[model samples]
Target: MPASAAKSTIALIGVPLELGAGAAGTVMGPAALRTAGLRAAIAGLGHHVVDEGDMDVPHAVPEFAPGELANCRNLSDVAAWTGEIHDRALSLLASGALPIFMGGDHSIAMGTISAVSRFCAEAGRRLVVLWLDAHADFNTPATSPSGNMHGMSVAFLCGEPSLTPVLGERAFPALAAGDIHLFGVRSVDAEERRTLVERGVDCVDMRMIDEFGMSALLRGILDGLDPETTHLHVSFDVDFLDPELAPGTGTTVPGGATYREAHLVMEMLHDSGLVRSLDIVELNPFLDDRGKSARVAVDLVGSLFGRSIVHRPSPRA
Candidate 1:
C-alpha cells in the first residue's frame, strides 16, 4: 500500500466467462485477482471498496441463426456473457461508483464498453477509451486468424456489423473511431492492421513508446481531453506488460512495457482524474509463476487509484 488520496466508492465486479479466448485458464482470472488482494489495495487508498463476487456463467442464448458467424468460436456463449455483462455494467454506472471490471478475458469489454458508451451518451459526455493492450484487438470475424472472439472486441465495440447481434437488442451506441486510443500495441494481425489505419484509430505502438517515451506520448492523449465532458475508460490488458515481468496471460508478447514504465502510465492517469471506469483483463493464473502476475496487476491498480511513494501536487491544482 502507498499513500491514500481522495475518497470514492470503487466497485469490483468480476466477470468469469472466458469462452471468448483461445485458452482454458482465463476463466480463473477473476479469482486470482481477488486472491492477490485487489479489494484491499484500493481500500488502502481510502476508497470504499465493494466486492461483488464473481458472476455466474450466463446461460447461453440460442439467439444466433445457424451459420450466421461460422468462423467465430463459441459464438453463442460469448454473446450470452456480453449481454449479461452489459446489463450489470449499466446498473453499476447508474449507481455513480467508479467500477473496475475484473475480467475473465478481454472479450468482456464488448459488454463493459457498450454500457459505458450508453451511459456517456445519455449524460451528454464524450467517451474516450484508452485501450492498454499488447494487441490492437480490432479484427473482425473475417480478419481473425484464430477465430477467438477476444481478438475482435474493439471491432465489436465500434459497431462492426457482424458482431452487433452479440448484444442482442441491447441499446448500443457505437463508439466513434477517434474516441479510441490504443496504447502499448506490438502484435497486430495483418488485416487488423489495415482496418486500424483505415478507421483512423489512434494507436501508440511499442515502437512509438520506445522512440518518444511514455510521458510525452501519454500527455499528448491526456491533453486533448475535456475533464468536464469526457468519461475516460481504461481497458488494461495484462499482456501490455513485458512477458518477463508478467507472464500470467496466455497471449504473452515480447518487448512490452517495463514495470516502472507501466507504473508511470497509471500514475499519470491518476493525476488526470479523468478515469471514470476500468477493465483489468486477460490474467490466466495457470500460466503464472507463483502468483507474480496478479500481484503486479494489483500494484498497478493501486497506482491508478492514487497510491504514490510521496505526496505530489495534483497537476489539476
Candidate 2:
C-alpha cells in the first residue's frame, strides 16, 4: 500500500436502490459485492474497513402530484431513497473516513455526489467528479427517452431545474458542469449528448481514449487539480467496463475499458492520492456469469486502494 493509503479508514455504505433503473436485479448489487469479499479486499491492503450495512428507503415520503414529473419512473420511491442517501452520505463524509458507496444502480450517485458537493463547499474545497461509465448520465426528464432516473442523475447533480425537488427540502450545492469529467463513455442519447456539449461537460469518450490513450487523458484530468483544495469523487459505474468484462450491470455498453486499462486507471488514481470518495454502482448479480463481474470489481478496487504488483515510491513523496 502507498503511504497515503496506509492505515486509512474506509466506510462501505450499501444502497439497495433499484428504482432509478429500468431493471429489477440491480437491487441485489450490494449483496453481490459483499459476497465477493469487498471488505476483505480493502482490509488486506492495510485499510480499516467498516461495513455500514445497507440504507433502506424511508417509508414515509412526500407525495407528488400525478402529473408532476410523470415521465420519471418510480419518482416517489427514488425521492425517498435520494433523501435518505444524501443524509447518510453527508454524515459519512463528515466522519473523516473515505466512503465507498456500494450501489444498486448509478442513480445512487444523485445522493452521493450531492453530499460530496455540499461537503466540498463547506470545507472550502472544489469538488471534481470523475464519472466512469459507458454512458454520459447527463439526461434530464425532458431529454431522457426512457425517463430512467439513473440516466438523469448527473443532470440532477449539475442542477437541472426540474429535478431539484428530488432531494426534498435539503439544499445541496450543485456541481458545476466544468467540474464533471465523463470518461470511457461510448453510449449517449442524442439529447443527452447535446446537453453535455451545451453544458461544457468534459467527456472523454471511447474515441478520444483510442486517440489520446487512457493514461494521457486521465493525467490531463488529474494534473489539472489543485490537490490542496480539491475533493475528488470518483463515481465508477460497473458498466464502464466492456460488457464482455462486466456483463452483470443493467446498462452494459459494448466498447468499454479493458481489464488492464481499468487497472491502470485505478493504479494511477492511487498514485495521485486525490480520491476522497467513491461509488461502485450498477452491478446486478442475477445477470452475472457466476460472480465474475463482482470479482473484477473487487480487483479493480484493490488496485484503487494500492494493491500493486510491485512497490513504487509515492509520487507525492
Candidate 3:
C-alpha cells in the first residue's frame, strides 16, 4: 500500500553561521533561499509553511585558545552555533512540525541531525540520514587537508573522535554508520574514503549513479525504509548539483547529479513518505548568478513536498 499523501506543517529554521566553511558569504544562504521564494514553493504543494526567521549564535562566541584542537578553525563560533541549532531544532520537533533547516553551511548538520536523532529516540522511531553532496564529508580534523569544520560534520555525527565539543552540552546519540546513505558523491579525500569504508557507510557515488541510474539506486535505498517506523533526514548540499546548474557553493565539484535526477530523487522520497526533516546547505549566494541556485533549490523542495508536473494548470494567455 502507498503511504498517505497529507499536507504537513513545516517549520523553516534559518541558521546563518558561515564560520564552519572555508570561506565567507555562506552566511547569506538563508536569505537567498527565502528571497528565491522557498516559502511559497512549499505552500504551493499544499503544505503549511512557517517561517521561523533567522537564528543567531551567541553574541560572544567563545575563543578557542591556540592549540585547543589542531587543524580546526573557528571552533568556538561553530560550537556555539551548533548548540543553539540543536536546542531550537528540538523545540521545533516538540511542537509537532517537520523542520526544514536552512543552513549557512554543511557544518550545521552536526547539530541539526543530533537534535533529530534525539527526537527519533524519544519517539521510538529509527533515524536514517540521506546525505546528498558532492563530497563525502567524512573527514576528521586530523584527516582534513583544509581546517574547515564543514568537512568534518559527517564524522562528528557518526561518533568520530576529536570534535565532540561541537555539540556543546548536548549528548545526542550518534547515528550508526549503516543508517547513513551518501548519494551523488564525486569528490572525497583519500582518508575520508577509507573512513567511510571502515565504518560500513553506504555510498552511491556518481559513477555508481551512472552505472545503475538514479531511479534504480534511489529506489533500492528507499525500499528498505519502513515509513511507519523510520524518520529520514535529507542533508542536501548545493554542491551536489553540477556547478553549471548551481554555482553558488564554495566547494563546487564537476559532474554532479543532473537537474532531472535530483528532482526524481525528491519525488521518490516524497512517495515513500519517510522524510521527517531536511537541511539545505552550502548555498553561497555571494557566488551565485542572480539567485539561480536558490531558485533551483526551492523547486527541488517543492518536489519533495509533493509537487507534480502532471497537475499543472494551463497558463493564462
lDDT of each: 0.90, 0.89, 0.88
TM-score on alpha carbons, each prediction: 0.97, 0.97, 0.95
lDDT of 1 by residue, 1-317 (tens): 11122477998999986788988898889899999999999898889999888788886675577654778899988988898999999999999888999988999999999999999999998899999999999988888899999999999988899888888889779988989999999999999989999988899999999999999999999896767778999999999999999999999999999999999999998888788899999999999999999999999999998888998866754
Query: Between prediction 2 and prediction 3, which has the larger lDDT?
Result: 2
Comparing 2 and 3 on TM-score, the stronger one:
2
* Model 2 TM: 0.97
Error of 2 at 268 (Å): 0.5
How would you encode candidate 3's per-residue C-alpha lDDT over 218-261 as one tens digit per residue?
A: 88887867777888999999999999999999999999988999
lDDT computed for candidate 1? 0.90
- Lowest lDDT 10-mer window, candidate 2? 1-10
lDDT of 2 by residue, 220-301 (tens): 9999676667778999999999989988988888889999999999999888878899999999998999999999999999
Best by lDDT: 1
At residue 133, what lDDT does model 2 achieve? Answer: 93
